[model samples]
Target: MYDQATIGARLRMLRKWRKLSLVELADLAGMSKSYLSMAERGERALDRRSYIAALADALQVSETELVGGPHLTKDPVQAAPHATIPQIRTALIANTLTAPLADQARPLPELLADMDRLDHSKYKFREAGRLLPAIIDELHVHAADPADEAEHRLALECLIEAFQMATFTTKDLGYGDLAHIAAMRAGEAAAILGDPINRGKADSLRIHTMPATTWRVRLTAAEQAVERLQPHVKDDTGVHVLGMLTLAASMAATVAADASRARHWLDHAAELAGRTADAPGDNWGAFSTTNVNVWRISLAVEQGEGGGVLELARNVEERRLAERRGRHTAFLTDVGRGLARDPRARERAVEWLHRAENVAPHKFRNDAKARETVGVLLQQVRSTTAGRVLRGMAARMGLPH
Candidate 1:
């Protein structure tokens, strides 16, 4: 099948050309009208080849016409010195830095705070990558023989957090293998030096890594993750882990196209979010009421409820969400996708995509759908200042320029 992002634009364009109502096309394709409508928009990725064949047949078009087109860049970017996962792989595999870590001399707490700077920054991986190996090395060496019990605990915590950050960064860029390695390392570290709470948090983080796995597999894993975390929800730490696990499960359910199952997880998450309002969050994300609402918008985007997404987006204060850079980047990406299907709001779609790129360069560049959205827009939006800017943005993103 063609990339879903390009499929939407082509479908929208061809449907208009054929003067076919969505109802007519959905009936012809034997799909629900809402699903056909979502496919015409960019929110629901048409992952199955069957959908492509059915739609092409109904439209009286060749499958290739619907599936293979120039508006999409089908291949991943070749290895660049600054390529996404390679740089991270290099960071994890080797440290080009000749000098050993002076971090060895730095207090673990101080070094951790420094690393936090990198974790929070958007796609600033090279700087973080350069620093991570040294930090990891120093932490590993220190943890091998702690001065005392308290020191051993701190050292273990540092390693767990480090591995957790590594897992998240790698996974977000679509590198599942590396993410699982890091996540497993985190779990291993936690298992050796953690209480029940720490183990639950580690489980939640590892479970969150499964999104890049197949949808069915990830959904199954999500169910297991929630069941495991459920019994631990008796304390503040338990509350945070439960919130994260439910969020992960809800997200997986959404991708699995099980709306009721997704809502069941979301309701569980909402309850956890309400309880965790006063609880602190670590790298997984803040799970407050507002955060739950933000995730609700995300789920709506996954379901291709563009109108509802926009409505929910309006209700949440952007600045507060924006402060959480990762989720803000996601929110903007979803906003851009939802808006691209609205002819009246198509201009704003470009604007929102640009905003998302600005917030997290890697999110747009590494994501095929985001790149396709820009590519399709570049093909469509000509003869305007906004169009020119979008063209520049797409070119910089390494679209077929």
Candidate 2:
């Protein structure tokens, strides 16, 4: 189970342990003393990566040390995902393209079919956890020793995707180290396959799975990814990959608080989205007009532009985000978190957060930001019913209410 203490509680303990006064720590972190106090008192939300990174640097600790995670919950549905993380870690460590650990693997066709079904695992965390380790092992077998050149290339493709799935599953479950391993393995397979499109996709995974720190470094990496992939973007798949890269750049710039750079990348992504429309069924990060708007809302929230977030949310054609359950839930949670930052919209924040949890219980319940939003809403619970709902959500997240 996760530590019941909130992030603020952890920060307080860490600060006192380091023997740093509030003002001293604030100065070190480049924030006002009062603002740091509010965060320590749980009166401010620590949902922004920038906040976490700054404090981590100031305190001489990893960001994960501040924002506790890999929260092993008691709920069976939620716990299932964490259960498989160990096996995924083992598979990532023990296997490689040259000498796979799995003694036997299924035929290439069977492995491909499994990959198709596991696509839904993007939202179905439990299902992904249950299947990913074995699939990764089997795919590695095929990748290591294919029946033909054609099958060799296809097997490598499947292997890269399996690693991508592993990347997301571990990262989502808060196993950051394991997620990085998976991403590196994916990049390895992409290189062997020698497909520029697949290579870009693997690059995206690596960038996205990076530890939530060093925004400027991440931004530079994203820009480099765009430059490397731009020449190969001749089809919808390439465009989707390139577009997602821009979205990644936009997000990194937002966290760095470079407003002009952020908007420039966002507008560039919007242009690419226009070309591809909505590739809902595409496994290439689901790049679309709707997804770009989703990122827009999220960036606005990160910028603390609550009003702009709502305006953008209202304009989103969410229906067009079909089958992209993760993006849809992200949209809802972003709105909820954004609104929770505003004292005037606490009630609405609760409603949107509830909707988000309803849409993807496991995803929403495990999300640090969603939990942070719930904590924020709980602070000013005005209605009896809203209080009851928020408490239930808190209980599921194992938060002290």
How well does each candidate superpose onto the true structure, as a TM-score? Answer: 0.73, 0.96
lDDT scores of the candidates, listed in order: 0.65, 0.82
Query: Model 2: runs farther than 4 Å from truth?
Result: 121-123
Query: RMSD for each model, in Å, please?
Result: 7.7, 1.5
Q: Which residue pairs clash in candidate 1? A: none
- State the lDDT of candidate 1 residue by residue for 233-351, as single tens digits: 68665777777778887877786678899999899888877775532224245676677777887777667664446787876666665546666677787788777656667788888
Reference-based lDDT, residue 129, model 1: 47
**Which TM-score value belongs to model 2?**
0.96
lDDT by residue (129-165, candidate 2, tens digit) is: 8888899888888888888888888888887888887
TM-score, prediction 1: 0.73
Model 1 CA deviation exceeding 4 Å by range: 1-105, 119-127, 211-213, 278-284
Using lDDT as the measure, which candidate wins? 2
